[model samples]
Target chain A: MKAKHQRLVLALFALAGVAGAGVLAASALRDEAAYFRTPVEIRDGKASVGEPMRLGGMVAANSIRRQSDGLTINFVATDGKASVPVEFKGIVPDLFAEESGMVADGRLRGDGTFVADRILAKHDERYMPPQMGEMPKNMKAPATT
Target chain B: MHAYANPTRFLAIAKPLTPWLLGVGLLLLLVGGWAGLTQVPGDYKQGETARILYVHVPAAWLGMGGWTALAVAGLVQLVWRHPLSGIAARAIAVPGMLFTALCLATGSIWGRPTWGTWWEWDGRMTSMLVLLFLYAGFIALTNGDEGQRQGGALSRGAAIYAIVGAINIPIINRSVVWWNSLHQGPSITLRGSSIDGALLWPLGLTLLGFSLLFGAMVLMRMRRIIADNRVAARLRRLADDEGI
Candidate 1:
């Protein structure tokens, strides 16, 4: 094998090395690479507009207000310290709800409302699930005020 | 490229080059590893899970990258009957396939804490999974029959697959942003990009290291291909003369 041909191959592969790095770096820079934010993180204005974020907070008492439109409903979710108003414009799950501990996902609307597309009902220690284990140290819910 | 078709000759030369390539690969890997592990900070939002980004992001980066290398190499071998290219393709296959698997796995693990689920059938995640299957298919095609190992045929199949896969890659990548889905929107993008510099540098370096590691491995595998060819040809010639 000629040294020249070998050199050419080496150079080409090396160039590919550079190209791969460029693609990764470029995407990471764009934040196209996503990671999720928790309730605390979401409240800090940490999630991007389209980035799917999960927030868990309690349903503020009497904050549930269903609109006449049937689909669009307004609810306020709070972590006690801060509260974010949410608007859901879709068929909510039967368990759909509000409270500091309920988690929701979707885009935060321009009107400072969390336009939730999905909702999750959380369970605490006293409310043990059938398949779930006993509450772990970290998952032990915060004492209710 | 044909000049180095002889395995022994390729070996003699590549053997010398091996140490140097290996050294460089290691250096880049370590440097990138160090940079990613040390330099990147906890995310302003995710806290510690943000640390996973340095590793998870690059793993995904290299996953796509390794396939591109294999598919391209296959194309070259098919078009030109370049034995070296075939070896390069095969050599890259394992690494590429492994990284793709790693990317998907890591992405899911990252998803659990953030998305609250271990899996989602979102466009990006699903497409990346398909890419992993493609890599496996290429590996399966190359194994077993030496007759099936013709550099031309093997590569042609791979090349076709690669090109098709590349088209899907962008669609998978853009799926979260393009359509309403559970996946997170791109934090890093073409313009108006916004990520902390602390995260970017290390993440970038990790990618460099991963790419370098791939090149070094490809070069090593090419040398092995040359050796196998030499032995295979000699055996064939002896059998022909005996006419047994």
Candidate 2:
């Protein structure tokens, strides 16, 4: 091969090597790469009890119930097909509400309830101006507290 | 490619083009900023916070786009030994770093009220952070003595690093989809955009403006580098004549 062709081959090989390494590394760290687990993942026994992990899903409709103490609140996180009850003892994020996406950092209890230390609101990609009026039926309006 | 190989020829085109690009880019930016800030209604959910999208989205696009340019330049420098390619790569670094930093800062600010956190180690955020670090490392490597000389060993190493670092771009783009992330998935895709037309138009305008501005800045920096190199070459000849 000409010198130019040789260099091209070398570059291609280097790229392939880097890509292969990336694929291997990503696959190996799959567990760590996932920021949170869905209710379905937990239900499928992907998560172990008492091991600290994050649970992410939508807050089921009417699932939010505040305890008398006011700091502690209970809600069920659902991915439609499966649901996991979650408990948190702090002021929730402003966007956190029934039917909105949330990611809770905590652990699954032996009783199956997830005890959360932190709660983060996860908004979807859609962006519509308020002047447009009512959101599409499939999309839920964020609850105003 | 050969036409641009001559620095004077390249400068002739770049010098005249830079001002036009900058002028049009700034005008578009002003219009986009006005429309995004005052003309459009607040988001149905995020309210006024969504206006940040105009600046943040453009910065994020250019941040990734800049690196893609660097990688392509690096590839040309390595394979073809193009004299101008190395200058182009060096010129891209600072602006690329600035855009990446801008993206991170804006994202963090947006995250505070929206995500209820200032930062997260989620896949999307983490990968973007990695991109920032990669830019930093590339800048440092290229600025060393090797980079000062055209096509030096360290410059080639920098080129290789640029090629390797490109791996992160795709990772950053796909992070929200490939992993669970606090950051949202892509709003605009090959399929279509989820953002409303009212909001999307300003975003489009800003994206184009920022991209043009980025191109102008890169050309200006390349011209500056070329001029500095010429002056340095003249000074070296003068020193040799003086036997110093």
Candidate with maximal TM-score? 2
Tell me the lDDT of model 1 at A113.
70
Q: Can you tell me which runs of candidate 2 are displaced by over 4 Å?
A: A131-133, A136-145, B149-154
Candidate with best DockQ = 2
Q: Write the per-residue lDDT of candidate 1 for residues A33-56, one digit (tens) a residue.
A: 332234455667776565556555
User: Hey, what RMSD does candidate 1 come out at?
Assistant: 12.7
Q: Give the TM-score of candidate 2.
A: 0.95
The worst-scoring run of ten residues by lDDT in candidate 2 chain B lies at B145-154
- Model 1, span B1-244: residue lDDT tens: 5797665676787788777777876787688777666655555334465566666777777777777776566556645566566677677777788888888888777766654567765557877888888878877877654633333235345555554455446656676665434555575665533454555666666667677676677767766565566577788789999995
* Superposition TM-score, candidate 1 onto the true structure: 0.61
How far is each candidate from the true structure, as Cα RMSD in Å?
A: 12.7, 3.1
| Two-chain DockQ for each candidate model | 0.04, 0.50
Model 1 chain A is weakest, by summed lDDT over 10 consecutive residues, at: A123-132
